[model samples]
Target: MKTFLLNSALLALTLSLSAVGGPTASPALAAEPTPAAPVAVPTVDVDPALWVVKDADTTIYLFGTVHILKPGMGWFDEAVKTAFDKSDRLVLEMVEPGAGEAQQLFAKYGLDQNGKTLSSKMTEDEKALFTKAMEKVGLPAAAFEPFDPWAAAVTMQVMGLQKGGYDVSSGVETQLTAAAKATKKPILGVETMESQLAIFDTLSQETQVKFLVEASKVVDDMNSSMDAMVALWAKPDPDGLARVMNEGLTDPKLYSALLTNRNANWAAWINEQMKKPGTTFMAVGAGHLSGTTSVPKLLTAYGIDAERVAY
Candidate 1:
């Protein structure tokens, strides 16, 4: 159970990363014109209505997917596949083939000062806590010395999940991308790799430390985290999402910056695509489709209605 929870915490982080949109753009860009405020998009009050969206000619199955999965977990339910089969194109946060570039972007945002390893930057107590956390997950303290705290946390979580049997190779996006490729379906991305990485780069140093501390706590109760995530994904209850947002998300400002702001941006992009001709089956993290601040709710603000489809 401990192993399962640890894997789930890792998986949850993966889902959040994939869905939240990576780091923000670099600070060197020219200032653009400010856009008008978004109108309040009316949300359809419904349960289990988070993932699917439809219209007359096109249907986008908004799957909230786990990026790592235990064998035979059955994340790809029949309804999800049926939606994929009916579409002309498949869209992901970032396609796997382009993942290398994404990693490069991530490296750029990470701390790179000489003689300033993440471990060295930590206070004595934080260093001790981080060391214990890593040991609990079967990792060496020095293994994370070269990276920033946020980057190190992400790495430790992914490595722990891999050790606990949640294989990324068996993830929903992996299978879906394969199927899309086999069928010659057009694949697309909601945002650029640089744009996603930029979000992390924009975080203040203090915020990064807070993220690391919260992540350490999460590692301690891996199974409960996994069970909570599984229950949420199995049925995207708004209340469940709210609870996770309230409880699981330790940094309120970071959560808003990472999740809510990006959801609005993605929602704006998705709305534009809806105006175009072809049918697209969009698969993003399930978390992006839930809660009051979700993509679907944002779409409502744009006057594009997204209805939930039955499985």
Candidate 2:
């Protein structure tokens, strides 16, 4: 369940929450601000051969994906499709078509057993900060009281991104899912919706407060962050990826709970999948594929190597 919320929140922040905007409109909306051209970060060099792992007769192409995208931003390079075409199945963190189930699960886990609002669970300072952030995103202060702070932060970020012109319809996952359907390839989910939500359920109230406060500070820069994510994703640099992720590590507990721990678990599942007999295309957030504790590195711990396919 941690995987789901983390993935969803990441998607919400990086991609956009407007899942119904469709592909055509998203690029246009994402283009509205006309972001300054990104300053080039030094590219990390990795072995291209190591990026493609092959066993006996089966192959698994690990494509790090960005959940949100901008107009004319070309993320799906030719090599990506070549890798996809070779795969017999498509695998993702969650296979559900839309965010509806995620929304419901968030509402459920956000509520207290005693029927009290989650805002009641926060410190006075935390509540004040949360309220200000909610207002900035145009949400009523009371609307988020029932849920945990982390959940509220994620929701606020999603809403803020939408206002900033990021839309989920422009996401790589959504595009891949559509393409998979068009090609008649089978799509499988690594985890269930309930399990995904369960991760959020385990967070302590204190961790949740920290998450909300930190998220609030960066709400305005979400669009820039999205652009930065797209730029870094294009480079596929593991070290660069780690540096981007580290920027969000203000809350140590939430950082591990939301990113590191979940990456370990996803890496385990990915390792198991690699042992199977058919080619599979695994599309997950680019952030999950980098870092010392990333899925690719974790796979190495289990003796299953994930090679990054060049674009």
Candidate 3:
């Protein structure tokens, strides 16, 4: 479940709660924002890739995104800015939430209102480790009792990223959102918060418990996991991103639900959108734009051509 949540395209940003740090449009608990370390690399050296799918009347730009990044990554270059300037609409995985929606999501799905607590699924040592991890992140153990294993897993990952100095405020989605708002372009969501959360919400109890146990065991390693992923992301290597995204995603059904199925759906949406007569700027997690089930590849299966745009 940790792999599923951490590699979850753009779902991480959408579901983050307050405990994980900052108000997310998605679900998470709360924590105060800590200062981030200075970016080790200059932005001028980074040139993230982009792609475009167009017909005579309509065009769609697909830009993959990282939901948490160190500041001054220099990813917003002229090519990206030019695409955004010509786009008539902006599309994301889902609409980022307003002030109180993340809290509502927590109450709705993350709470233990039914009396099932996270501790119930852990062994003695696991419980101790979980407690220690919670304290390490400055969250009280009881504060996470209400969370289901999947939610707890996501929270742990988010906390790990925060601790490692990744900043959601500097993420691509946040910047593009601000830009779209500033330019008065209409914003569209391909899926709803409920639909996205339902992916984990619908997992079997056995799987959920397994996820919790595995997450507890590796709570301290989340930084290294994210660091590896960020390294691949910084390279802008689609094949490497696909490989990293697929790491530990061994369960076929789980992979389908998390990546394959969703990618197919998004590809279909892009296909349908192509029949319309306007340009759209679409940004999703980089993972979704890579791999065999990527939006571009899946679109090819349906006979649409999506060409990679050079930096």
Top-TM-score candidate index: 3
Question: What does the lDDT come to for candidate 1?
Answer: 0.61
RMSD in Å for model 2: 6.9
Model 2 residue runs over 4 Å out of place are: 1-6, 9-50, 97-104
How do the residues 1-311 of candidate 2 rate in per-residue lDDT, one tens digit apiece? 11123464445422332343313312322333433544444433322111455689678777776565444445554677777787898888777634555445544664554566767777788777778877777766675555566656666766676667555666677888888999999998776656655676787867666677767766666667766655666655667756776766656675686678878888777667656778888777667777777777777788877665544
lDDT of 2: 0.62
Model 3 lDDT tens row, 66-122 = 877766777777788899999999998888665366556655665455778778877
For lDDT, candidate 1 versus 2, the one ahead is 2
Pick by lDDT: which candidate is best? 3
Tens-digit per-residue lDDT, 1-311, candidate 1: 12221222233333333433433321111111232343344322222333555566655666666666555555454666677787899887765434345435554655443537777677888888888877776666764565566666665566555555556656667788889999999888775555555566577768777777767766767645655665666565645755664566657676776668878988888777766766678876666777788888888887777877665
TM-score of each: 0.79, 0.80, 0.87
Error of 1 at 252 (Å): 2.6
Ranking by lDDT: 3, 2, 1
